[model samples]
Target: MSRARSDPDRKLRKAKGRTASSARWLERQLNDPYVKQAKADGYRSRAAYKLIELDERFGVLKRASRVVDLGIAPGGWSQVVRKLRPKAAIVGIDLLETEPIEGVTIFQMDFMADEAPAALSQALDGDPDLVLSDMAANTVGHKQTDHLRTMGLVEAAAWFAIETLAPGGAFVAKVLAGGTDADLLGLLKKHFRAVKHAKPPASRKGSSEWYVVAQDFKGRE
Candidate 1:
């Protein structure tokens, strides 16, 4: 096992103070137990624990289920899905390239474009059991603009989920915390039996991002 797997907290503390910004980030990592545990568990990113926590709370993943992962660069979320359901077919798509991961098919494409969802559906070969979007727009230093941009991606992902989700499928996407998501939540409530928002432990404490999980697709459209 790697040293990070054995002494994650020590590694985080040692990583502190290399640079002004890095010092603060390291302090946060050291204080976050999830980050330490993720290092010890050999996961690629701390984001993996968010998926694990969400699944534990929602009972989302299942053996042999088909799962779609959006914005899956760096492969952490995909790694979690693969570990949880070894028999499941997993497909991941992102604008940036991702290194090959065992048992995952990755497509480098901008999913916000019109043609992306069709390409993703073609790759899946059938409807997916679960669709997960951990996508966020690159921060432009304007809070309102950033929120709108992120919401656009979330809405697009939700629309694609409506198109390709299996009858009883589930969709989960990241959203900003403020009241900006009310309209989108209303739309989701119409199509899903239950919809709830969650802030997983692995996420940064100061981040505006939260996840909206919509379960039991009703196929309204």
Candidate 2:
């Protein structure tokens, strides 16, 4: 693990008008060992470790697997997937452009568009072994609004997974932990043998973000 280094400019700025929240955020970022370690490891974001930790626990990555990554901008999670499954076929899409990375094909487009999933499926050429979504809508500051927006994205991603996943495949997606809607959970339980929520250590302590892991996908058209 790398030690955290102080930024003189940041310290000076903090001294000028440090609100409690700002100070806490700065302190957390500076003292976070994972943040330092991620920088040293060349990951695009600390969120990369969240995927790594989840994969370690779940054994999701496999050799030559076909994988789909939704909202993969910044490319941290996609990078981890490529590193773990070097020969796997990966197709990543996001509303924002991501710099190209070897061994993965990235598409820049809004996934909510009518043609996006079809385009993604065409790129894959067959049902995927895994579908991973790290998508979160831009927050509007209202907790209820944010939750609804995020849930919408999750629902859409789940629908796509249902259409494009092979039997016995997996779907992993980010969701808020207030509790998933019973309707959605019931739908997932119907199609997957196991559905559980996970919070990897790399996620910030105060964030509501958690991942839903659905395994043993039943092929349902």
Best prediction by lDDT: 2
Each model's lDDT: 0.83, 0.85
Instruction: Please provide, for model 1 over 92-191, each residue's C-alpha lDDT reduced to its tens digit, 9 standing for 90 to 100.
Output: 9998889999988899989977788877788778889799999999989998898889999999989888888988899988888763377888888888
TM-score of 1: 0.87
Clash pairs detected, candidate 2: none
TM-score per model over all chains? 0.87, 0.89
Q: The CA-based lDDT of model 2 is what?
A: 0.85
Q: What is the lDDT of residue 123 in candidate 1?
A: 77
Query: How high is the lDDT of residue 158 in model 1?
Result: 92
Model 2 Cα lDDT, one tens digit per residue, 161-218? 9888999999999999765677788888899998988998878888889898889898
Clashing residue pairs for model 1: none
Residue 119, candidate 2: alpha-carbon lDDT: 87
